[model samples]
Target: MKDIFSTIKIQVNEKIYVKDPETSALGRKIIQESILLMEEIGFDNFTFKKLGTKINSNESSIYRYFENKHKLLLYLSSWYWSWIEYKLFFATTNVDDSFEKLKKAITVVTEKIVDDKATAHINEAVLNKIIISEYTKTFHTKEVDEENKEGYFLIYKRVINRIVKLITEVNPEYPFAKSLASTIIEGSLHQHFLRDHLKTITNCDEHVSPTDFYINLIITVLKK
Candidate 1:
C-alpha cells in the first residue's frame, strides 16, 4: 500500500492554492518544510515569511505558491484527508463481512499514525498531529460556508460518508449511521487530543486505544 501510495498524487482543491505545491522542488519544499514548521510552531504562529526563511527563499516566493498561510493550511488539511480516504478505501476493499469491513474502516481512521516513508516530503505522523490539533482552525471561520460551497471539504465529507455506508450495510435499520460515522471520525481525534494533553478525561491511554473504544461502542450499538 505504501508503494502504491507513493505513486499516487494526493489531490487538493485547486482553489486552496495559487499554485500546486507538489509540482516543483521549491514548491514541494514549501509544503515539506511548512508541515515541520507548523507542527513546531502551531498554525497561529505560522507564516509564509517564516516558511521562506526555513526554505532559504524570499517570502514573495512562498506567495507564488500560496496566497497566504490560511490557504496553505487548507491545502495541507485537504491533502491529509485525501490520503486517509485512499487508505480507508484500500483497507476495507474486498472484505466479505460487513461488520468486519466496518471495523477495518474504523481502525484505518482511528489508529495511531506513523510516517509513511513512501512520501518523502510529507510525514503522516506529524501531519496527523496537525490534524488532531490544528484541523479545526481550517474550518472554524466565517469563510467556511463559502469554502464549503466551493467544495473545499468534499474529501473529508466523503470519508465520513464512506463509513456511513458501511454502518448502514451492517445494520440496515440503523437510522443514525451518518451521525455515528461522523462521531467516530471526529471523536477519535478528540480522544487522541485528550490522551495526549488532558489524559484524565479520556480512557484512551497506552493500553486502551481510541480504536478499541470505538469498535466496542459500534458493536454494542449495532448488534442485533
Candidate 2:
C-alpha cells in the first residue's frame, strides 16, 4: 500500500516538474533574440549556435523548446501577426466613429510595416520564403477536405468581415464593399513591400511614404 502511494506521488511530481514559468520566460526571450539575429544576418545565414550565444544558452536548450530553426521562424511569423492584431485592437478601442477607427487601423498597420526596424532588416527573399511556407502549410495537404478549406477560409473571412463592417458603417451605398476592403488590405501590403524597388524602376527620385499612400488609397476607395 505504501509503495503504491509513493508511486502516485512520484508521478504527480514528474508531471508538475515540466511546468516552470521561468523556463517559459527564458524560451520567449530566446525567440525574440533569434528574430533580431535573423533580421541582422538574414535567415539563410542565421544559425542555432549564434542564437544560443545571443540567449546565453546551449543549442540543446533551444531545441528542447523548439524543434528547429524552421519552427522558430514559424513562431516568429505568428508573433508578427499577433503584434499587428494587438496594435489594431488598441487603435480601434477608443475611436467613437467607425470611419475614424478604419482610418486608424490603416494608418497603424502601414506605419508598423514601414517603420519596424526588424521588419526592414528582413530582406525580400526571406520574407517571401516565410510567407510561402506558411501559406502552403495552412492550405496544402495530402487530403483536401471541406474542413481544411473551411478552417482556412474562416481566418480570411473574419478579417474581411471586420473591414467590411467598418466600410459599410461609413458608406452604406458602396457596392461589394467586402470585396473592395479585401483588395485594399492586400494591395496595401504588396505596395509597401514593393515601393522601394518600384520607385527605382520608375526613376522617381521623390520619396513616397507608405502611410500617405495608404491613407490616400483608402480615401479614394471609400469615395468610390
- Highest TM-score against the true fold, candidate: 1
lDDT of candidate 1 at residue 161, scale 0 to 100: 97
Report how far off residue 33 is in candidate 2 (Å).
1.3
Give the alpha carbon lDDT tens digit for every residue of 172-192 in model 1: 999899999999999999999
How good is model 2 by TM-score? 0.61
What is the C-alpha local distance difference test score of candidate 2? Answer: 0.55
How many clashing pairs does model 2 include?
A: 0
Candidate 1 residue runs with Cα over 4 Å from true position: none
**True-structure RMSD, every candidate:** 0.7, 11.6
Error of 1 at 162 (Å): 0.3
Model 2 bad stretches (over 4 Å): 1-23, 113-161, 172-179, 196-198, 201-207
Best candidate according to lDDT = 1
